[model samples]
Target: MKVLVTGGAGYIGSHAVQRLLRDGHDVAVLDNLGRGHREAVEALRASSGKEIPLLEADLQDRAVIAARLRELGTEAIMNFAALAYVGESVTDPLRYYENNTAGVVSLLQAMQDAGVKRFVHSSTCATYGEPEVMPIREDTPQSPINPYGWSKLFVERVLADHAAAEPGFAYAALRYFNVAGSDPDAVIGEDHHPETHLIPVLLNTALGKRESATIFGLDYPTPDGTCIRDYIHVSDLIDAHVAVMNELDPDREDRRQMIFNLGTGKGLSVKQIIDAVKEVTGVDFPVEHGDRRPGDPPSLYADPRKIREQLGWSASITDATTMVRDAWKWFQENPSGYASQA
Candidate 1:
């Protein structure tokens, strides 16, 4: 299968590309280098022994995207492009709407024009928005509290509508939780500017990149009085994506649209994650308690039974210890992340 992976130079996208290549699929990366690193793609190409074609362009460039879709003869598109920071999205809603929502509209138009029907969308659990229920399911009502969540939900609606209108279109929206860990080989891993993820932030603090890791809200009603979240390994998350790609039927007259929640069906608190990092790296790091960020849910995890029974996909890397261990290995190898390669 020849696939075009948008934002393939980013952390999760690059890991997805690596999985695609390893599965014997031809992959091309389309990234604007806005939040993506070019070195990640190069490292993937080197590690996979494949010349991964890279089209440096934005998703909103309809003409360029359409041309690239036709030029590459892409059979499928795995879209990972978006502005994901919840705080940033709150500060600038227009940017989030334009890039995350409108950008998908442009990509959909390009796909429609080029007759590329299969799309694997990288959705998020943020769409669930402070659910009162535990272990969120696919049927959970999408009442997103933040602009970032709304942006993703908007695109998801677009995909659903497109699939309904076009009989040939097929799509899979994988709503993910906190995706952590790196490739076991330590070749590629999480790298973000002013990283916001809990595990990586704690690991960075462990590495002495920062003074201390802040624990937000120890007053939440949980096992440890802190908010808990589901953390999935990057490799396992990509595996589910590829599984959906292979399962998609672009020629189906019914126009199949699949939505799945990808997670380990477990939640770990912030303190637990910090403790795991300390255990993994054997580093006692300073910690500071802080107020809860507004709109933060007490607990967010996935049921995952739907995807497990339907797609026969389940997360294999379930332990927080393993996640922290793999991430710590990568951090030790590339203390400056992709910058070390540059």
Candidate 2:
């Protein structure tokens, strides 16, 4: 199958693209290069000896997307495109809504016009907001506290409607937890500018890229006085995407819409992750404490048993030591990230 990845050059998107290709599918990536890097694609090309086709276009422009999809003869679309920052979304709600919510609508519209059917939508656990319990489920009531979660929920609603109305339009919206780790090859990795994610930030601070990482709301109800979360390896998450997208069918009843949670179904506190990083890298990174931010919960993890039992998909790599170690390996190799300056 020939697939189109909407945010193919970004961190998770690029990693997903690599997995799709490994699954014996032809792939073409559509990235605006706004927050994605071209060199990530180039690194794959260098390793595989195949140049991935990439388009420099945004999802807001539907015309260009339609043209690109038609030109590539794409069979399915895996959407990993969105602006995801909780604090920034709080200040700029409209920006998150426009790009994360409305942009998905445009992408779906283009797919509808192109006669494309299968879809693997990249969603987040943010839609679950501060989960009511430690292990969040798929059917839980969505009570998103911030614009970022609301924007994702809006897209999930749209996908549900499309699955009902259109024939042969099958979609699987995988709600991801804290996605960490890097490609085992060490060629491609997380390189978000003005980095916000914890694993990368800790690695950066260890490398002296930043001064210190702040532990927000450390005095929570957890045993370690911090929050714990379910961190999933990016590669394992991508494998699930490939497995679902390949199984999509248009004429099957009660099979068009599938939602799954991607994680190890366990929680790890902030201190545990920091300790793992220090254990892996042999660095004592400085840390500080800050006030609790809005829309943050004490602890949230996933019960990924459904995906494991049904799709034969479980997170095989459950080592935080490796998660931190592999990510630090990539950071060391690409000190300046894909820019080749470090």
Candidate 3:
């Protein structure tokens, strides 16, 4: 399979590129190098010993993307290109819709031009939006609270509608929870400007990169009075993407849209994650409690049985400690992240 991974220079996309190459798939990267790091793509080339093509272009450039897709003979696409900050989305909702939602529209146009049918979309649990249910499922009603979630949900609808209308088109939208940790080998990992994810923030505090880590909402109605979220390892998340991509057969008569929730079916509170980071890094970092961020649910996890039964895939690294340890290893190796290489 020849796969074109959009945003392959970013954290999770880069990991997906690595996994695809490891699994014997010819891979090419299409990243704008906006939020993604070029050094990460270079590192992947060095590690894999393959001259992977990095198509430095945005999804909005439909003509260029379509030309490249045709030239490379791309069989499938794994989309990870989007602006993914909740707070930022609140302030600038239009940007989220333009980049996350409208960007996919252009990409789909290119896919149509190239006659590519299989797509693995990087969806999110935010589409579920503060559900009353404990374990969210594929059938869960989607009522997104923020523009970020709405942006992704819009794409899910686009994929579904496109698949329904177009014959031989198939897509799998994996709505996943909190994606944590790094590659086990520490080759390429998470590094976002103004980093927002919890695991990296905790690890940075432990590394003395920051003075302290702030725990938002210590009064949530939970065991630790904090919000709980499912943290899936980056590797495991990529594994599910590969499984779905491999399973997508456009020639099959029954091929259509597939939606699955990716998680460990386990929830970890902020307090538990903090403890795990402390134990993993052996650093007692300063911790501060703050009021809850708006729209934050007390608990959010996934009912991963559907994906498990269908794809025979489950999170291999379910322990918070192990997730923290892999992330800690990456932070230790690249304290400044890929910036130094740049």
Candidate 4:
């Protein structure tokens, strides 16, 4: 299958592209390079030894997307193009809506015109803001407290609307849980300008990128009075994408809009993660407790039974200690994210 991966130059997007190619599908990457790095794309080509065509373009512009889709003869689109900063989303809601929500609108139109049959949308668990249930399921109602979460929820609804109006179009919205860790080979890993992911932040502190780690709000109603979250490896998350495409093809009659939550059913608390990092890195660093960041929940995890029963897939993630070690390997190898980008 020939597919176009929007935002394919970013961390998770690049990982997804690598997996798609490894699974025997042809992929073309389209990214604007706003938040992504170019070295990641070049590195992917060099490491894989395959010529993965890349276009530096944004989906917000219709002409560029349509031209590229038609030129590439893209059969499917896996969209990962969005500005994902929860705190910033709270302060500047328009940016989040424009990048995440509005960007999808133009991209959807381009796909509709291009006759693209499948779209695997990169959504978030943020859609289930302050989850009322222990293990969040697909049917959970979306009530996002912040604009970022609301923007993701809005795109999910937009995809559902598109599926309803156009039977020719089909999609799978994978609501990703706490995605962490890097590829075991360390060719590509998670990197951001101002990193916020818990694993990376902890590792950065180990590397002295920051003074020390801040455990946000230690008064939560959890085991250690800290927040707990489910962390899924990057490789495990995108594997489910391939399964979704395989399960739902053009001829299938179950044209119903399908939603899948990706994560391990188990979880790790903030304090537990810190301990794991210390154990793996062999470093005893000072831990600081700060005021609770607004728009944060006490505890959140996953119930991946739906994806497991339906897609026959479950997370094969390394232990938190092992995950921390693997991440330490990457950061130690290249303290700065990518060689060229640095």
TM-score for each candidate, following the candidate numbering:
0.98, 0.97, 0.98, 0.96
lDDT of each: 0.91, 0.88, 0.92, 0.85
Q: Per-residue lDDT tens digits of candidate 3, residues 270-301?
A: 99999999999999999998888878889999
Query: Candidate 4's residue-wise lDDT over 227-266, tens digit each?
Result: 8888888878888887886676655657346689998888
User: Which one wins by lDDT: 3 or 4?
Assistant: 3
Clashing pairs in 3: none
Q: Highest lDDT, which number?
A: 3
TM-score of 3: 0.98
lDDT string for model 1 (1-342, tens) is 999999999998998898888888889999999999999998987888889999999888998999989998999999999889999998999999999999999999999889898999999999999888888999999999889999999999998888888889999999999999999999899999979999989988999999998888989999999989999999899999988888899676533788999999999888888889999899998999899988888899999998899789999999899998988898998999889989
Model 4 stretches with alpha carbons more than 4 Å out: 339-342
How far in Å is the alpha carbon of 72 misplaced in model 1?
1.2
Count of residue pairs whose backbone atoms collide, per candidate: 0, 2, 0, 0
Clashes of 4: 0
Query: Which pairs in model 2 have colliding backbones?
Result: 168-250, 218-225
Supply the global lDDT for candidate 4.
0.85
Candidate 1 lDDT at 167 equals 85
Angstrom error at residue 147, model 3:
0.7
